[model samples]
Target: MEKVMMILAAFVLTSTSRPPEHKYVYVDELKNWTEAQRFCRQTYTDLATLESQQDVEALSDMATSVRKTSELAWIGLYDDVNSWRWSTSDSDFYQHEEMDFNNWQAGKPNNVWLGLFRDSWKWVEGKNFSFRFWNEGNNEPGNNGKEECAAAHFGRSGQWEDWPCDQHKAFVCYSELCGNASLPGRKYFFVGELKTWTEAQSHCREHYGNLAVMENMEDVGTLNNMAASLGFTSTAWIGLYDDVNSWRWSVSEYDLDQHQENKFTNWQPSEPNNDAGRESCIEMFANGSWNDITCSKLQGSICSEVRDSDVKFTFINVDMNWTQAQSYCRNHYTDLARVRNMTDIQKIQTLIPAGQNVWIGFHRPFWMWVDGSRFSFSYWRSSEPSGSGEHCASADLGNSGQWENWDCDGQRPFICYNVVCGNSTLPTREYIIVDELKTWTEAQRYCRENHKDLATITNMEDVRMLNDLATGRTSQAWIGLHEDVNSWRWSMSDQYQNQFRNWAAGQPNNKFGRESCGALSADGSWYDVSCSQTLHTVCFNVCGTNPTFYYSSTKRSWTEAQSFCREHYRDLAGVRHLSDNKVIQGLVQRAAWMGLYRDSWKWADGGNSSFRNWNRDEPNHNGKEGCAAANFGNAGKWEDWSCGEKKAFVCYAAVQSKHLVKLQLEFPSSLTEDDSAMMEELLIKLKQKLKDDGVKGDVKVSWRKRPDGKILHKPKKKKDEL
Candidate 1:
């Protein structure tokens, strides 16, 4: 089916307006990222740039007409050293920008190579160096190649310096033309200068409209046309990039701030430096300004909604984490109230009691849920979760369900909760102890085989139950809490459901620089390795009776294996427990990536659910890339998977029912027509006879569709063949 673009008319209903009339179009073609970008720009907007949840929803809605939920496409979102942007200032795409204005922290943008921030610098040829604000004491661009990019540091009066291109820093891109266009009117030029991603970003900012922002396939086609015109083929830089999930309104209406002036944010001078790497969620001060905090921090949640033409605000008095609070608000009312403008903010302010901090729907792009649950809460311990790499969270049952942020390998008593049981009829809370301590993944496996899963404590009662279970234990035990270091979510869950993680020791290292995928290692541990590696695959099948896992002898890449398993059985294996891992372990000996890959945390279905369960060490690798998998060795804790690696995977399917019903009848001997054809006629007459006796509703007489696509057919057979 061909994708059609629709201009949804705006209407007034609630307290705030929609963002803008973003024209969304979908391209039904297979092309790499660059080719897709070119096509979108020439035809419509750039490769369907998605800046807001509304934008994502709009594009998803448009694509649903031509694509399945599991199908993938090229959106204008690629991880080019973490700089995410759109082709123009379109309201929809701007949802990814944390703050529109520039307010850099002091000594910021000192582009550090590999993990070292230095006063370094280097000038790429043909790139504009016109803008300069050197500091007084050490303003020179450092000689180290690591500090190769520049940033506007608030510390040095907003001066600039060169920094590493891969440090996951914030950047500003300028498009000479910021207007949203339907067709290709402006010409995009290909600058051949060898520049870093940031330098190219700078060059584009200085030159033609910031590195050719493509809006749709037409725009992409224009670029492709440009490439064809110039015969240039190597990868040229574009404006779409990002290292972090930026902040957007919790209430994701398109016209919430159409004028863009509503984006005026009040922040403490030098606020949102992301103090630690984990500070991605937003917090509003009493004065209505916003600051970034870790999602695990405990705080009150502020929610707002439009009811009966009047915007109402509700301040939940509970102290819960961001995800938990999100679940609470969604379970009771609308999603965490999205504050679109000052009017909404003021409404929220009047409701919030003095000195009470709360979480709104506002959040950065990453740190989403695996089951696509609401990411509306955070409960991090103060001054905790201080790490530059990918970070995950764990709940501290010993501390009133308060959570602590730690590295991926931090060993602690993890928890898990189960909603579905294999045998039990009703929901039950059965917390079990494993005297034999193991990694988070191992512990998860142990709990699943014996019990439902690792324990999940949703409220104080559940936490108290855990406390009672751990009363006499000397040290902390593992629970079913997990978060993504990459902030990526599973494809099946779409970022709005609960997740349980179990990683191995020193695992998810993202070793050798290209480890964006995850693999289940021997002994049930998980590690982040390159996605291109080939290994055995695992498949899962959900037949009658119970879910069964299978190991395949054929080896293929993650994509191929996923395709094979999906075609033959089900999609790649999604191991939910320790029993799952042990079952898979029995099948294979070496390592392989599962169907679980990472997509930074996001909620699906707008605000579908808000439940999460993870082991302590999670969301590793700077919360960037990698899929998720359960490691049975660590109690089925989750880990990341690289999509390209060929690993044994698992697939599942629903039981197929046979239409032919067998009957043990008595008077058949008197009928005398025992041949198969005669039997068929007799069965038809028998069905009609039964219907005559009032055997209606699901007792209709119909022939089963044959394997050759025919409803009425019978195979001829010899006596021996029959």
Candidate 2:
């Protein structure tokens, strides 16, 4: 193999992820999952779409350094195929060229669909050491046996490179393949011997269409089993793809009814997501089940109709939260979850590891149907939520073949499933937001009416997350709690729970008559407010991490604070209105009068240093005195200090440790537990640090009304987050 030099090793996987509307870049230099999604949305766009093999190829060529050991970059759809539709528009056409110009700054497609095909990762060449992308688990890197997505690229000038499919690198995903290459159409009847999937797709496309598109479960089954019977293990192309659009099947007039089952078609459990138009093709897993995955995902697949029903879908052994599991099933399986028989249970058993019990469709959080029918009061192996408010429940196959009651609010573990297992299909469920805004009584009403309860918060992260959403607001909404007719009961039902009461100050004391609700507030605090007050509350939907590192520019001698902020912080902190500036202007005046001088009492970005007290009649610099600083003393007494003057600096860094921001978001990972523990330490340390540094007078830390109402110690439930 002839290798050319000159390619920069420092690869940059650039992508234009579409946020709610704007486009964002990954900036891999410093990004974690949460912040990465935030940056994509709040800053740029949502994420890049890797819809086709060509798109994957382009991205690999565009990305960099896939020397066989690179991290598998995330694309749009591993989670659920149905939800696999593009984040932007699920419309039929995606203008590929229009994307070339809109690609985000770089390193995007940060988030990925959470699907893990059985351990078969697509590498550059061989297996094992050759694996380029490294998925967190046996999650399908490449859908079928052959892995294609293992190939990723960075930079616009390098050669397309391949890596281990599981590698975790930022990647570029294209919506469609922009090229002149087009396959012609034709007809065939298995002339004599069998054909490799690749060969079949190529020949088929050249004659019968660009790869066959399987329409339904029957169609997929009809094809894969045929290939397996033929003893084919190679890869094949399929008409099913999401690039440009999802519905435009790769092949023309691809029909299933016209063709009869040819003795070899078959499918695995819950096959064919057709999610957002995903891997509509078939690739038999080593275990004989059919994995309907992403075409670009690159796996060893075969052509022809599926013919096997005995093929059980294999589950990728990956750990996921209940909400995540639900989401995954919806995307890939086209439903919530199913519980048909013991085999289905065994199939699901493959998802989580031993010692971990997760929530499945058999949960009875609110009401349980007696043989799929009504409000039957049923108690399980476990007792009620005696102490801690446990809202969600799970199956405890650990003991008797019955369900066990655990706190769904706890977020322990979860599993996803497909159909071929012959289990009944999953049902639909509309959630009641535990983190939504609602009054105590109002929240209870909403929960009772719906098939849910006021969302119960279970962890510190949830408390902090809820608070983040309720920031700048007053009055906390209610969480699922209250004195239900004299007893401390959960709105969902009386399930067995271990922990309880997370109240702030004299909380849940049945204030003013009786306390009937609990709520989380802004600032990671939990509390019990009066049931009558109106405030935003949150609901748990079950969800999901990562932080990016940021280092600000050191010194530029900005003449104006606004400019200084503009050059730094990426932009200015909330300015509000000019009236606010008027109040600040007075401080500039005093600073100028205090023996401080620049060309004039200039601002940091070079404007009239109208701070402190405008040295009598100021504005003499004609807005040129742009350096503004607070007087050495006085709360708002600002001054125009020289840009060259060196003073104690306040450096801003990207809050790399959201879970540990209170520890000053330190670089030392082992410093503290997380926000719940360190927040108290931070408050104490910040006060002490400020006092010792003498900045107490210069800079003050104003305490805002704690939204959660709880003191720094009380934690919350994880399910109560947005």
Candidate 3:
């Protein structure tokens, strides 16, 4: 395919006047010529065989084209089929050069015979400074011993010669330029020395009205022509940036057409990632089109500016870890724009930019909203909260980016929307609307075809202020919740509908496909639609949760008398945060570890409480420090630290389905009738299983015990013997 492509490219130059529009296909840089050719054919095309002067001119912009005015490229010309002819020898277009391109470097055409191989001449010049070539098996040039050999050329100036297939050198990447003309209306082009996007943009604007923008191969060809005129080599930049998943034009306003389709496109694998969440810029040259690039890089760039409108605002990664929201805003937007008021949000609805997501200044408490409003509301998903002391809110401009309250000091990537707001509202139910470029369905699709679920209303206050707040949206948003399939369950149960749903009248009918999605009501209920229907929606996922009795337990050594938690009731559950501790403590009747110590009586659960809410100071250690247990009926069943007591100790493990996953499923029964309810069953099983599984136990040597409970053949038994 590579050979065929190059030939076709040659034919195109012979037939047209346009310069070559080639996009270099990168290969393993370590590849030799033969392997490189296979890779190109498999990736870009065959080794480049220049067939036209225009092709020659266009190739001038590429550094790897490797035509040194004399060095001959290995085209699809071989006599392997017993016929020595150029692969594409039809059309009588072969160059009748004034000098042979197959240069013979100092007797390089000599064929030497050695060993058992048949006698023949080799292309060995016999010196390191001089090039040599041969057929190893028969020590001959040309194809012999059923082996393949190739002819080399030094163009018209150097001597003609032959070479062994094993020699290594750089090869050319060519495409069938005769295919469909390149896509058109691209918004940026590369020029001169590589420059960072900002520098390039500035330079481009000063020169050819912003770097050339190309959306198609024809446009690429035109740029190629432009580059040929200016003399550039190697890869350069285009206007694409990684907004998120793929590359999109940086100055999207200048975009006139979309990208074109080409079979010879190249990709450097797993690229175009904008995952640090902030990088939304794009670049060219990893095989072809545009792939996302890191914004911090100083790569070559192409800029675009149409005659009708001027694009301002440059994107830059700041130099400090101490970037303030206000500083970021001042640097990007004008004068720390008053906390993104409703009007601003509405205006931003329309200009969703090409690719980027960021938090606006509306989040307060973290930062003072100049509007002098009390920090009273929230729009959090389940477990919505405030006062971890974070008062700032980041709004997602792309709808795909969600709105969230973040720590004031947290570092995050941000986007600056061109549409100004905090001013007025648009007169449409749809403040801003964008299509869902990627196909999706109701349950699967985000509220906005381009964004996530929907808009949210924190409290009745926000809802009342919403029509005014959502300067762009008069209608309510579709929350993430609704009846999925047949059940009337929200997609995320955590995001329960706040009191401010604006469902259309008589909505959310649970009839079959009717209640598949969530559409806010003008009054109360939500309207459900077919899960496949694509519609706009909004959500507010806001609610406040106070610190409460969220409880969980951990492992502690125990015995048979108590079930896990109740053993250290006073010590473990001792109302540390007095309020929360007491809150759940009332419900726990059985005594459990109050996370306390009895010997030192130190609280085991770990806290700074010096006072133990003990039951009348009853933690009297009876010499042997056993575990503690309390009678719930006893007043303040607390404060007990007996580590060795035997009780039906409750051991906790995560429950899967209804059963806990255990290392050893089967337990062994012990013969010690006095051992109280087979207490060692689990331990014995673990030891035996570990042995069987080749897991060694502490290898301390021990003696066998006699039936009479005495050590066998031992002089004296140690007091601490097990």
Instruction: Give each model a TM-score.
Output: 0.25, 0.17, 0.18
Residue 393, candidate 2: C-alpha displacement in angstroms = 59
Per-residue C-alpha lDDT of model 2 across residues 304-411, encoded as one tens digit per residue: 121232223334334554345445554554333332334544565555345433333221113221111122233244553222223223323233212343333333
Q: Model 3 — TM-score against the truth?
A: 0.18
lDDT of each: 0.47, 0.30, 0.30
Say which candidate scores most in TM-score. Answer: 1
Which ten residues in a row are the worst by lDDT in model 2? 1-10
Query: What 10-residue stretch in candidate 3 is worst by lDDT?
Result: 1-10
Q: Report the lDDT tens digits of candidate 3 across residue range 1-722.
A: 00000000111223255544443322214334445556456434455544344433343334222213223334222222211123343545545641123322453334433221222322111112222332233344444432243433322211223444444544444544323443212222233343454454344333222322222344334444544544443334332221122221112212122213101122236643333333334333312233443344442222122344332222223332112533554544442212112343334333333443322222111221111112223222333223333333443222322234444344332211111112111211221222222211231243334433222222212122322333333222222111122223332222331233333465544343222334322222235544334322221111122322223333222111111222111112222233534454444332222221111222222222232323465444334322333232332133333333322211111111222233313334433435544535645655576578784534222233468874322245578875
Model 2 global lDDT (CA atoms, 0 to 1):
0.30
The candidate, 1 or 3, that scores higher on lDDT is 1
lDDT of 1 by residue, 653-699 (tens): 11222346544444544454336587687678878887888855445
